[model samples]
Target: MGNDNDIRHGRHCVFLMHVHLVFVTKYRREVFTKEIIDDLRDIFASVCSDFEAELVEFDGEDDHVHLLVNYPPKVAVSTLVNSLKGVSSRMIRKKSYPSIRRKLWGGALWSPSYFAGSCGGAPIELIRQYIEQQQTPH
Candidate 1:
């Protein structure tokens, strides 16, 4: 009842991909201040939204950040990493923390590389529930 191309395609499958990403500061300088961390949270959320992804969980100390994200199939992992790194670096240099500029020596806020791992079959919903339960009231 359908054409050859249509028949070959079968049903459309939605891919639910969860990735845990870790990004470190250049030379591990520990440059993230509380103010910078707050700003980074906002920026990361906005960027993830643009890419049709959800920033499920995010936290960082001064040197590194951990992000759990749910990404759509159309997006490339490298593209998301590059965008986040590049934009956050520029923003950190320009506004949030000028001290980082001195430390980076005109290079970058984040290291050249990142770590990404799949959360496949890892019960992400349960993890989310645990994180939510741990949240403290302000």
Candidate 2:
């Protein structure tokens, strides 16, 4: 059964916003290893925490990664993506991970563009029908 409390409660607003994000490596280079993926998971979790968001799930191959995040309404998706990429790139570089650096030429872990899609509880058509059922003026 689905959890009734899936919707998050903030001080002044309640929301259940989620975004599916996909980030590819620069030039589609295969740079990930088991250790690097582990580090990336931790880094992503930390970054999500900093933005009051939850990293619901994360997984990746050598060239790209996917993240499903539940974020508050106040946080912009772009800002979160930028921070995630920026912070992770910086942190990874600070370490001695030659595998990543050797493959990536520029000083970037992720490509310039990414994919973000919204996830919500109800379908738009269902919501539209529900809206149509609302009582109107006599």
For each candidate in the order shown, give its overall lDDT on alpha carbons. Answer: 0.81, 0.90
Let me know the TM-score candidate 2 reaches against the reference structure.
0.92
Span of ten consecutive residues with least summed lDDT in model 2 = 1-10
Kindly list the per-residue Cα lDDT of model 2 for residues 1-138, writing each as its tens digit: 126687888899878999999999988899888888899999999999999999999999999999999999999999999999999889987886888868876688789999999976788798899999999999
After TM-score superposition, the amount by which residue 123's alpha carbon in candidate 2 deviates from its true location, in angstroms, is 2.0
lDDT of 1 by residue, 1-138 (tens): 223322222146545577899999989997888888888888898889999788888989989999998788778999999998888888777783666866777657888989999875447787788888995979
Query: What C-alpha root-mean-square deviation, in Å, does candidate 2 show against the real structure?
Result: 1.7
Q: Which candidate is the best by TM-score?
A: 2
lDDT, residue 65, candidate 2 = 94
